[model samples]
Target: MVVTFDVSPEKEGSVLNYFYRQLTQTPAEVRGIDLGGKTAIVTGSNVGIGLECSRQLLDLGLSKLVLAVRNVSKGQAAATELSKDINLNPGTIEVWELDYASYDSICSFVERTKGLERLDIVILNAGIMATEARINPSTGHEETIQINYLSTALLAILLLPVVKSKRPLAEQPGRITITSSDTAAWAKLDERNEEPLLSSFDKPGKVDMLNRTFVSKLLGQLFLVELAKRVPSSVAVINMATPMMVYDSEINRETARSLMGKIVEVFRRRIGYTAAVGARMVVDAAVKHGEETHGQYLGLQKLKPMAPIVYSSEGDHLRSVLWRETLEEFSFAGVEDILNEVNSDRKEIL
Candidate 1:
């Protein structure tokens, strides 16, 4: 029933708040947590925060860990490296390919989830922040929109039924934690004035590469707000875990591959948590929370506010539009169809 945080959008979108959070960042308190029989899937696991999260999950006695990555070979290599660090039982960890850039890949990955007997945790760590306003050939949306918002929305909606179906009648609702950013609060979202908001995102020239990632996360919060309403916490626990600013995360260096990137990396290393520390946030999000976490935001080692605008009148309009457009976009993937066949208890289309 909670529509948004009590703070007004304008009041919450302050740089000082973010700086204070950065100055106070601490490691998430999730180490030694019991996860004996849990099965987990972490996207973008080959490198950066996802790899470290995969390591921490296994370290915590997670029984089955799927390192869902864009590259199978890299995932295998990461798995091998992790084996060197931990006493991995045979088949304790697996590497599955999941490329968020492609809709086919996302759908194929969902199809493969039917094989899982039980899925206790799903941390959607795959994302990108494009410095260029490049349009995806397949989806025709900006890269940030395609990967960060649209594809993620598609995958999460489709995965809800699968995540819930894997649980026993008495088991706790499965965790679906998606990474979000505090920067999301900073987005002015000038495009909100556009009558058909999503279309403005699809137009190449309209996207401001510098602000698109923040915009995408803002858009994502709106999507999550709507999604949580349709599917209750009992059906599937959903939330966003923000790592603040992890300097070594994959998305961090993705755009800064040059000398500027190296320079920025140094600054990032100095200020932001290492990938390992950041992974603690991701791990905490998946295993250490419950129904209260459903449709909420967790950051700085605890529950926090969502994007500044996420619950405003504007946020409501934007979320509704995002839900409508995104639902239509993924309609071809049969998200409704999948739920209709696998889960009947949930009345919503999802």
Candidate 2:
């Protein structure tokens, strides 16, 4: 399995700039903001950056906050813990179950969103860092790819309509932000030329464990490139906000027991930003700025392109390939019809 990053001039330069910002830039904080009437939902809110993002939203006076987790009981537990830190009005925060690993769970969560009266911001922060490749029993895709890319795409597609219709039509459009990473620039993506690209990702032997999350994040950026073309910023603003590399965020919980994880943790505490500080970027993406940032990458809270390769002719070909295969993968759920409806509803965007 491939374990090392593909070294190149592009990767070297990008990584260097990223590290410089990480070392020199001051951590971001969302201030002078108020969400008194807005409602927001965050996945993976039980711990790490998600939890702190939820906290910041509530502190800003978000009327309703939903912590969508895989386990309702644990989500409730998290909600309780959140309540103790700050005063929470009755029903201010709600716990909803959403498991990214299961297609049914994601679909059901979307269905539940129909009951909400308002949805101003959605931060899709739930993802895993895998140290090895494994297949999801419910969905046949590799675990990391399934959770971070495919299922995230499915949920984002389904939620776009809900966000569009329920938006309060404030000064700006509703936002759907995904937590992306700088590591995406390092993926080799040898599978780009495969006829059935997703299947190639499913082969455990074909994927390197270390690069799995990076591959998933890159796939997400590729999907977004195609998505923005079909669904315009007017319909709903969507973008990727990467915090670069955050330590003490516990996003790598999957590898917590491994020797590599321990070493990474030591350095993370020494060099990486705290989860609270890292989450400000996620909330910043959701609340600050407007249409200019739509369908773009917010690297360390700055507008940036996805990857050097995403602009190449080869990247263009791969984008079309990924779109076709991704839709086919979810055809059983009428995903194509869902996207077509989104496109048709936003015909004014054209």
Q: Which parts of model 2 have CA positions greater than 4 angstroms off?
A: 1-13, 169-171
Q: For residues 102-185, what per-residue lDDT tens digits would candidate 2 score against the true structure?
A: 999998999899999988899999998887788899988888999999999999988988887787665456789999887888
lDDT of each prediction vs. the true structure? 0.81, 0.83
Candidate 2 lDDT: 0.83
On the 0 to 100 scale, the lDDT of residue 101 in model 1 is 90
Model number with the top TM-score: 2
| Model 2 steric clash pairs | none
* Candidate 1 lDDT over residue span 255-339, tens digit each: 6876777787787777788788878887887888777777888776677778767767877777878788778888898866754
Worst 10-residue lDDT window for candidate 1 reads: 1-10
Off by over 4 Å in 1: 1-12, 258-263, 337-350
